[model samples]
Structure formats: structure tokens, C-alpha cells
Target: MTRLYNDPQAFADEMIDGFVAANSRWVRRVSGGVVRATRTEPGTVAVVVGGGSGHYPAFGGLVGRGLAHGAAMGNLFASPSAQQVHTVAATAHRGAGVLFSYGNYAGDVLHFDQAQERLRAEGIECRTVRVTDDISSAPADRADQRRGIAGDLTVFKVAGAAADAGYDLDGVVRVAERANERTRSFGVAFSGCTLPGADAPLFTVPEGRMGVGMGIHGEPGIHEADVPSADGLAELLVSSLLGEVPQSVDTVRGARVGVILNGLGSVKYEELFVVYRRVAQLLAEAELEVVDPEVGELVTSFDMAGVSLTLFWLDDELERLWGAPCDTPAYRKGALEPAELIDDTELAAETAAEIPPATAASRQVADVAVAALATMSRTIDEHVDELGRMDAIAGDGDHGIGMQRGVHAAVDAARAAHAAQAGAGTVLALAGDAWADRAGGTSGALWGAILRAVATEVGDERVPDAAALARGMRAATDAVLRFGAVVGDKTMVDALVPFADELETAVGDGAGITAAWARAADAAAAAAAASADLMPRMGRARPHAEKSLGTPDPGAHSFALLMRAVLTTTTNGRNAS
Candidate 1:
């Protein structure tokens, strides 16, 4: 049913055409499908890299200012031919010479070796660096036999920096080899990817099972295990990496380390953070000093569900290189800073003391709010079909499902807090935990943070009047805006901005809490309705801004409903009193 090209040769050519077209500033195709980018410092030692084509940014995207000078691109899952590698090396070679680097795959080795010989015969000096970091691909004693994973980034950066520093060809090759020696990576796949127009996936795994040691190109993993929670997954990955590194308190006492939490594809950033939280704790337990941690979709397989961890043991020189100023379309290394020394005991104590206690009245409010939210949760779930359909027109379809999960978790936590007779702050804390656990998206996390901010503002208040409510709303709005840059950009702000404004107006008019809430709810609903004609300017939908026109944002609609429920409840309570 797919209209995309099924032929690997055709697909590869088309992809390379599009890639070169979009990235002319950084890359261009040379003879034999070799994409080469001009070096930032011409006449410096050149780094030529390559791998299969499907891994977009890898090998290809790395060819830029502070990374590889040339990339030999191949067909999806297939290595570039010897001519491709030779052409890339020839194009990238400076008078200083060229260093060839690539993952440790049979075909890559064979092709790159052939290219190396060809380049040498042409009177161009050349050497090679192979990355073998995937522990799953080889035995502990044979780690050098494993295929490369995400650690390719480290090799490229280190080698590129060495070359930029005026290292000769052999010296640059040594730096790259050292990077490959010190760096390690491992990955697990939750799902497989489809190859272009293939009717079936390139490979298949059982449902709810994760393929450990899965190759990025759909090769069989070591084994499939039952899917684990994000925390569990992080633990698994951290344990494996730690085993390889074998850190002792003494070994890590004064050492700085770089931790990279990379998503394969389709794994949400929120989920990645959850994994990072656990990984951070694990590293701390091992007493390894974390220098700069990066978490995101750095290397991806097309639509595959998986994540990989890359650990680079940092030395003073490597640290300097890692922190060196470099810029590319996908990666940028900001200015470097000295690692801060943190006392573990002090950190633990501070965290414990910062958690505020919850009160009885706060628990009551939380209980009622939870029940109301739970009832609304079903509404969110039911509307998911519609929401996903709407989102598919302009953005990803997870918005509705993400919200439903988040609201349900928040309600559930509120119920638990109420049963435990938690104080106001504690109830809010519980709500935050629930939000983080269930929301699994940027908006959900933003909403959760907003709730926690409001709870912190309200504190132990037994009865929040119009002024207090207004202050709380203002705090919540500020928190959301701080967490995400979507406010005033046609996101939930379409409804929330009006709700806060109406609340302020009501309070200024000397309206009671109930009346003010009612006014705010009406304004929020009206604003949400009005947003149907506005264009989205934030989030993933922003890129397709025109497509979202004439449709109300799901976030705005949800905000309006929440305000309506709160207003209705407040009015009923006032009338009963």
C-alpha cells in the first residue's frame, strides 16, 4: 500500500538527492554517492566517514564544521561501494592527508579497506579508524569485534578536533582510534522499522518484547525480553555500560564522564528524561562524575522504538575536545565549564527537606478535584480518536492519548493523597509525580509543572478566595510559560490567557469566588472556540502552521473543559453554603 520506492538503489539515490539539496551549506554529493562537506579549516588533516544510508545523520550528517570532512553514503542496510569510499576520501583529502572511519561491519570493512588501498595508490596518504562499541554484538573479551552504535559521534568529534588542531594524518587516526577505545554503546529495540515500500518490516519482534543488542539496521538482537518500564530500561542499559567500564569509587573519584541518552526513533523526549533520571542516579551511586549529559533523539532508526546509551570516559584532553566550540545542523557543543563538585550527602538532605507537607483541607480539595478530573478523563479517552485524527492533519497523533493518560494519573494520585490525608503541598507533589509518570509528552509535563506551581502558591490555604485563586492562576500560567515557549503562540494559551484575564476582571469588579470562576470559565470556552480560526505557531504543529488553521487546539479545548468543571463545582459549593 505504500507509494514510496521499494527498490533499494532507487531509494538510496532519491534520499541522497534530497539530503544534498537540503544541506548544500554543509554537504554535497561527489562521485559514487559520496557526500563531502568542506572542512572548516582547509588544509588541516581531513576525516572521511561512512556507513549505510538509512542512518541519516550518522556518517553523512556528521560531515561538517567540527566533525567529518566527507561521508560515503550507501544504500539502506548496505555498505557504500569501494568506489564511493575512494571518491569521498579523494574529495576530502587535504594536503595534510585523510583518515577513514566507519562502524565495524563486514561490508563496511571490506569496502573501506579497498578504498584505502585505492587512495594510497593515488599518492594520497590515508589511515582507518573502526568503532566497535556495541557490547551485545561481541563477547566481553572480544568487544573489539562488535559493531558500532551511537559511539560513532564520539569518534567523529574527537578525530575531527584532532585534525582541526593540525594533527598529521597518522595522529588524527590515532585520536579516532583512542575515541573508539574509550567509548562504548548499547541499544535495545521495542519495535522494528519498515524498509521504504516493503510490505513487511525489515525484521520482526514479538509484541511487548524488546530486542536487546538489536542492530540499528534491523539485524537480530541478542535476545528479546519482556518490555520494561523506562526506569527498568535505564537500569538495564546503565548496568551493562557500567559492567563494561567497571568503575570503582577510586577509579571514578576525580574523573569526569559524558553520558548520552539517545532515542532510536518515535520515543518521546519525556520518556527519555524519565530514563535519564534513573541513569543519573545510577551514575551517582557509582560515584562517577557526570560532566555534560545530553538526552534526545540524536541517532534514530526510521520510526523504530528504542534507545541507546553512549558513555565516553573523559580525560582532560578529551574533555577539552568535547567542550570545544562546534556547530552543525543537528549538534552543537556549547562553551565548556569546569565540572562542579557536588556533595552526595548534602544533595540528598536538600532534596528531602524541599518536599513540602500536605494538609487535611488540601487533601479534601485534591480528592474532589481528582474525582472531577477522573470523570473528565473518560471524555479525553473518548475524544482521542477525534484528537488523533485532527493531529494527523498537522502534527503527531499522540496528543489526545498523552493527555488522557496524564489526567488519569493525576486523578489517581489525588485520590491516593486524599486517602492519606496529605497536606496541600504534598497533594500537589503527588499530582506532579502522576503527571510525570502518565503524561509522557512535553505538554503533559508542562501541565504537571503548572499544577505543582499553583499548589505551591496556594500552600495550606483552607479556602482560596477570588484574589488567592487569581494569584494561583497567574502562578500556574507563569510556570507553564517558563517550561514551554508555547504561550501566546496559539497553544493552550488561547483558552488559558482568557481564563486568567476574566478571573482578574471579575476580582477587580468585586465578584465573589464562584461568580469569578463562572466568568473565567465562560471566557475560556469562548477563547477556545475562537481559536478554531487561528494558526498554530508553537510545538510540532508550528512547522505546518497553515494546516492547523480552522481547527481548535486540543490543548485549548481541554483547558476550557477543566475551567468549566472547576467553575461549576465552585458555584455549587457557594450555593450550598
Candidate 2:
């Protein structure tokens, strides 16, 4: 359990500040995260890696020479916002380009891809190589769908080394892909992790039992079994990985590999050493040569009592890169020449965008929008724990906190835009940006898309009507569908699509906006409730589908709740404007 925290919502930001202050020599403060304080070679490709905040050394800790040039740190258990990623990449880019790498998760994919598009639009070359090295997340035939784990170290190390060795964008991507293809990892959990201020752990394992193939994010494991002795546990981990060796490696005999016995958190070094002790014997027995093996925490999941084993199969080039001298806040290796520190220390954050002019009617609608946003903030605050409890059934248990962060930011932005005399559309759009930027996860991105899509339909000059809102809802549904989740995927799409369809149908039937919206909210609520029976086919919960069978998806439930909450606020005949 996490004991020390001032504001749970402020934990990630506070932690980053303290970390930067302590590691100023290796990393300097940037808007999104830390960039290497040490100067890099001109024209070197900047390797920017990131994900959620709970994983130490994985993201921020790896920023230094011969590793990630910068890392975009997000809230705990949330992916960094697209704005954050773009900011870090822009700052880190030397002259060659930027290579983005991180664990293969849905939120990370969405935000990082968005950032990549933005960078390319500005003529800064950007490429991404998602780390899909966790063997337990997916089947061998569908390896690309695997989520990354401790194997992230191998990919990042090789990418950083290749970038520093003067590889261009293409060359860096190629080597990074090579490293990803050659790595495999498996993990087990003896206990669940507790988020700060949470009443209980995300998911608890039975006493004397261990969860096999557990995710680093407190996702329940594929199976559970009686905990075994250290040697027995090592045998299980080693044999499991050995059975699923990468296709590139024809055989395990005589293959040189880089091994990492990573503690997920709360697993002390001595325990990890005991497990690695037997892991080493097993690898040697299988005739594999180990090089530069790491036996400590690299990637962690807060206080999860879990450990993962990663085997990075190394060819000649990869071996040299793995052995390259490097320095970072964490995970320093062989000595290196003194690095020059960067001179410019100023960090000017971009402020709220200027508000566009609005018509009187539109400004009236903007006032209503601001009020609706406030209602949403209050609604989320009231039901945050309920939403989080639902998500914790099969997720990392951060849904409540993520929503709290997003809705609060949305409310703040909407209030600011209203004060600036912005239109309803402009206010919602700005609020949406803040929601996504502050929340930094799947829910955040979806809400942002939904708001922006709705904003486009009701421009600055027009007062939003029933038809416009129905159309906006349809467009929002389309935006979500583009992310590849369907109605039965046990995601927000399950509730949102039904609500949009119901709204359009009701409005087309000449029903008033109030009636149509209420009807749509009812439909959404039903869909969200029925989601309790559907297996999760998307996002982090997919790995623990069985565990979610009787629970509604947190995303779907939250969307439904938010819809209902907004409906109540717009009760002046539901056009509100």
C-alpha cells in the first residue's frame, strides 16, 4: 500500500518534480517530462519513450545519454496526452528526427500516433515502434497485439544506442524493430498493487497462490496456482519463456541473450536475486549464453508484488548496443566521457489559446455549456469510485482518478473559455483539449474526440439545435468507431453508438430535444448495464476478459453517466441555447 501522498491526484506531478530536482545532472525539466540535461551529438535521432507514471526507470528514469532523449510522463497508470508527447519530442529532437517507442497499449497508441501526425505536419520527421514483447498478452500467431513489459528496456537501449551511433530515422526504427522482434517476457504476481488513497488493492491473489502471466498494470493474471519455491518459480518462468522463443531464433542452443529479472515493485532486491539465481542455472542448462544480465527493478507497477523475466536474444550488433556505456537517473552502465550540459533552462508552457468571437446567442449557449461542464465535474466526483470499482474488476483501478482529472480540467477550461466570451463550440473544444491533456488515457482521448466532434457541428456563429446535436453525436460515435472498437466490444462504444442511434432516431421522429436526449441517455444506460454480460474485447481488460464477465466496463458506464448528467443540466427544453 502507498502510504505517503498529499493529494492523490497530484501524486504523479509531485513525484516528477522531486525526481527532477534530485537527478538534475542527468535530466532536466520539460513541459511533459524530463529531457536529458546532457547535450547530445548534433543530428542524432532523439529516442523519446513514454507511458504511464507508475513504471519507474521505464520512462523518465531512462532519459539520458545512450537511452531515451526524453520521456513524456503521464498521470499514474495513464498514457501521456498527445500534446505532452509532441512537446517532449519537439524539445528532444536534435536534427535527424524523433523515434517514439513505448509499451504497446491502446491509449499510448492513440496519443502517440496523434503526436506523430502533428510532428510530421510541422516537417519534423517522426517514427514509432511500439514494444510488443510480452509473450503472455497475446497468442504467438497474433504477436503484434502483445503488450510490452520489461522487454521495453531492450528495445529502448538498442534504439538509443543506434540513434547515438548516428543512425538516421529509418535506421533507428529498423534496429528498434529488430530488438523488439527478438525479445520475450513473462510475469507473475504474488499480490496486487494498491494505488495511493485507494481503500484496497486492485485485485488480490489468494493466499499462498501466485498469478501467472499477470500484466504490469495490476491486470489479473491468466491463471492462478499455489506459490512455489524460488527454484520452482524460476523454472516456471524460464520454461514458459523458452517454450515461446521468438520465431527469428531457430533454436535456443548457443544463442546469446540479455536477461532481465525485473521486480514489479514491493519485491525486494534479495528476493529477485534468489529467483535470478535459479533463472541463471536454468538458462545455462539450456545452453544459452547470458550477457550483461540485469537483476533489479527496471519496470514496475507501483507496489505490485510481482516479477517478470525478459530474455532479449542478441545478434552481434544488438550485443554491442546492449553493452554500450550509458547514464541516466536510473540504470547507468559502463563509464563514459563527460557529457556537456544544456544551457537553455527556460521552460515556457503554452497557455490557453485565444478565444474566438461569438454571437450573443452563441455566447448564451456557451454559458450553458460551461454550466453543463460543471455538472459533469460534480457528477464524476460523485460516481468516481463507482466507476473505478467497475474498472478495477479487470483493469488497473485508476479509472476514477483518471476521470476525476479529466472532468476537472474540462470544467476549468470551459469556465475560462466562457469568461473569455468564447462560443459554445469553442468552449467545448477547449474543454475537450484540457480533458485529454490532463487525463491522458483511453477515456480522456475518447471524451476529447467526442467533444471536438460535437464542437465542429455547432460552430461559433450558430446556436446548437436538436438536429445539430444528434449529428454531433453521430460524428462522435464515428470518431470512436475509428479506433476499431465496436458496439459489443465492452467499451464506451457499446453505450455511445446505441445512444447516438437512439438520439438520431428520436429526433428524426420529430421529438423535442429534451425527449430525444432523455431517450438517448436511457438507451446508453441500458447498453452500459447490459455490457456486464459481454466479454471485454478491447483495451487493457481484454487480457482478463473472464474477470470482467459480471462487471460493466468502466468506460461505457462513465459515458452513460456523463450523458445523463449533461442531460439534467440542459433541461431548458434541452436546446439550452
Candidate 3:
């Protein structure tokens, strides 16, 4: 368990600050994360990598002369926001373009793709290569769905080396993609990790047993078994990977591969060497030549008692790139020449936001929106522990925190907009931006989309009626569907769709805004409770859906709670009138 923390919510920020302080020679502070302190060659393709915090050397630690130009750090176990990614990319881009690379998780994919779109819109060439290298997460037929693990190092290393070697945007992307294709990893855990200030671990393994194919983000393993001896464990890891080599490789025999025996937090270095001893013998026995086998922690969960092995199949080109000289705060290979540092004056200046003009009537409605967000903030705070407990059943236990961060930021932004005399639509839109920017995960993105959709319908020109609100709810449902979910997928959509339908029906039946919202809230609550029986078909929780049986989805439950809270706020307004 994590023993030290000033405040649980502030852990990630504190860690980044300390890291930058200690590694001043390698990295400098940026808005979202750290960029390389050292300057790069002009026109070189900048490699920007990122993900949730707690995966140390993986993201921020890798920012230096020969690795990632910058890293967008997010809250623990959550993907960085799109705004974070774009800020890092903008700061890192030299003259040519930028290449964004990270693990293939849902939040990471959503945020990185959004950042890529933003960069391109501004005429800055940006591309992305998602690393999918965990063989245990999916079948070889659908390898693209695999989650990245220790193999991330191989892909990032090669991509960074390629970028350092002056590859253009296309060339860097190709190398990164090829590296991801060649790399494969599998992990096991003796115990689960604990988040800071959390009273219990995310999951637990029975004594004398181990979890197989677990994820780095405290996700429970797919299977469990009695703990094996060092040799036995090494054989298990090796055989599983050898059974399904990359499509490009005909056979493991006579192939040269880069090996990584990664320790996931609690595993000591001596234990890894003991396991690697057997792993090395097994590789030789299989007639594969091992090149530059790394045996240490490269990526890690907070304190997970686990380890993973990665194999990067090496061709001539790959071999050269793999052996390229590099230097970073965490990992180093060969040697690197000294580089110039970024000038103090070259840092980006903060820009002020330009609020659109709003009419007086619109400003009045904006006050109501601000009040609604305040209600949401209070409601989320009240149910945070309950929501987090539900999410901990199968998913990462951060939904409650994410929602709190998002709604609080939304409330703050809404207040500012209302004070600025902005329209209701502009207030909600600004609040949505803050929610997404501060929340930095799947829930955050979805809520942001929902708010933006509602804002479009509740324009500044008119007073939002029950019909307009229903239409906005319908649009919110559509946006959620377009973001890739259906009613039975066991997501928030299950509750959202019902609420939207019931709201439209209630409004059609001549209900007032408060009445319609109260009815919709009831529908959403029923739908959310019903979701307890559903097996998840989407998101990180899908693989372990069975474990979540009889527990409501955290997202669905939170949506229901938010609906009811907002209903109360509206009803109160009506009573006051």
C-alpha cells in the first residue's frame, strides 16, 4: 500500500514537480508535462509520448535528447487530456512535424486522436502510432486490440531514435508502427497495486498463487494459478510468446530479438535476474539469438507485485535502430553528444481567452447554468466514494475522482463565464472545455461531448424550453453513440439513452422543464440499476466483465445521480419563481 501522500488528488502533480526538480539536466517544466531541456536539431520530427501518471520511466522520464521530445502527463491510471497532448506537442514541435505515440488504451486513443486533429487544423503536421504489444489481452487475429505494456519501451526507443536520426514524419511513423508490430509482451502479478490514500489494494491474489496476463493499470489478471518456480515461470512466459510470433516472422528459430524482463514496482532487481537467468537459457534452447536483453523496470504500476517480458523481433533495419545511441533520465544506451538547452525566452506565453458577445437575456440564463453546475459539483462530491467503490469492482477505481475533477472544473468555468456576462450556450461550452481539460479520461471526454451538444441546442438567442432541453438530451445521446457505444454495451449510454427518450416523451406529453427532468431522472435511475445485470462489451472493463456482475456500472450510476441532482436544481428554481 502507498504510505506517503500529502493529498490523494494532488499526488500526480507533486510527483511531476519533484521529478522535474531532480532531473533538471534532462527535462524542463511545460504546461502539461516536461519537454526535453536540451534543444534538438532543426526540422527533426519531434516524438511526443504520454499516458497516465505512475508509469514513471515510460513517459516523463524518457524525455531527453534521444527519446521523446515531450510527454503529456495525466492523473494516475488515466490518459492525459487532449488539451494536455496538444500543449506538449506545440511546445515540442521544431520545424518539421510531430509524432504522437502511446499505449492503445481507450482514453489514450481518444485524447491522442483529438490532439492530432487539432494540430493538423492549425497546419502543424502531426501523426500517431498506437503501441499494441500485449499478447495476453487479445487473440493474434485481433492483435490490434491488445494493450501495450513493457513493449512500449521498444517502440518508443526505435521511434525516438528514428526521429533523432532526422527521419521525416512519414519515416518516423513507419518505424514506430513496425516496432509496435514486432513487439510483444506478457505479464503476471503476485499482488495488485494500491493507489495513494486508498485503504485497500485494487485486487488481491491468494497466497501461493499468481495472476496471469494482468494489465499495468491495476487491472486484474485474466486468470490465476499457483505460483510457479523461477524456471517454470520463465518457461510459461517464453512459451506463451513463442507460440504466437509476429506475422512478419516465420519462426522464432534463428531470429534475433530484443528482450526486456521488466519488474512491475514491488519486484526487486535480484528477483528479476533470477527469473531472467531461466529466461535467457530458455531463449537459447529455442534457438533464438537474444540481443541486448534489458532486465529492470522500464514501465511500472504504483506498487504492483508483478513482472512482464517483452520480445521485439529484430530485422537488419530494426537491429540498427534498436542499438542506436541514446540518453534519458531513466534508460540509457551507448553514448550521446552534448546538446544545447532551450532558451528561457523561448517558452510559450500564456494566452487570454476571448469570450463571445452575449445578450442580457442570455446572461440571465447563464446564471442558471452556473447554478446547475454548482449542484453537480456538490452531488458528485457526495457520491464520490460510492461511485469509486462500484468502479473498483472491475474497472480502475478512478471514475469518482475523474467525475469530481471534471464537475468541479466545470463549475469553476461556468462561474467565470457567468460573471463575464456570457450567454448560456457559451457558459456551458466553456465549462465543458474545462471538464475535459481537467478530467483527462474517457468519462471526461464523454461528459465534455454531452455538454457541448447541449450547448449547441441551448443557444444564446432563445430561452431554453423543455423541448429544447429534450432535443439537447437527444443530441447528447447521439454524440455518445457516435463516440462508439450502444445501449446494451453496459456503459453510461445505457442510462443516457433511456433518460433522453423519457425526456422527449415527457416533454411531448406537455410536462414542464422540472417535471420532464424529474421523470427522466427516474428513467435513468431505473436503467442504471438494470445495468447491474449486464456484461460490459466496451472499454477496459470488458475483459473482466464477469467480475462486475451484480454491480452497477460506475458511469451509468453517476449519470443517474447527475440527472437527479440537476432535476432537483431545476425544481427548486421553479419553486422560487
Of the candidates numbered 2 and 3, which has the greater lDDT value? Answer: 2
TM-score of 1: 0.56
Query: What C-alpha lDDT do the candidate models reach, one value each?
Result: 0.70, 0.90, 0.88
| Residues 1-577, model 1: lDDT tens digits | 2256755325767887777778766666675453334434457887888876667577677766666777887655556656567767776676778888888765577567767878888888888889887877767676666778788888888888788778787888776777788887889998777656544454566999998977676555667899998889989998888777733223755567888898887689999999999999988888888877889876677667889998888877787777666555467676423223222232111122134455556656665555555656766766756665555444544455556656776777877776666655566666765664345344555566667776776665474566877888888778666544554476787788788888989999998877888899899989887877878755546535676788888778777877776665555552211
Sorted by TM-score (best first), the order is: 2, 3, 1
Per candidate, the number of residue pairs that clash is 5, 0, 0
**Looking at model 2, which ten-residue stretch has the lowest summed lDDT?**
343-352
Candidate 1 residue spans exceeding 4 A from truth: 1-8, 33-42, 246-250, 335-577
* Poorest stretch of ten by lDDT in candidate 3: 568-577
Candidates in order, TM-scores: namely 0.56, 0.97, 0.96
C-alpha root-mean-square deviation, each candidate: 23.1, 1.5, 1.9
TM-score of 3: 0.96
Question: Candidate 2 vs. truth: CA RMSD?
Answer: 1.5
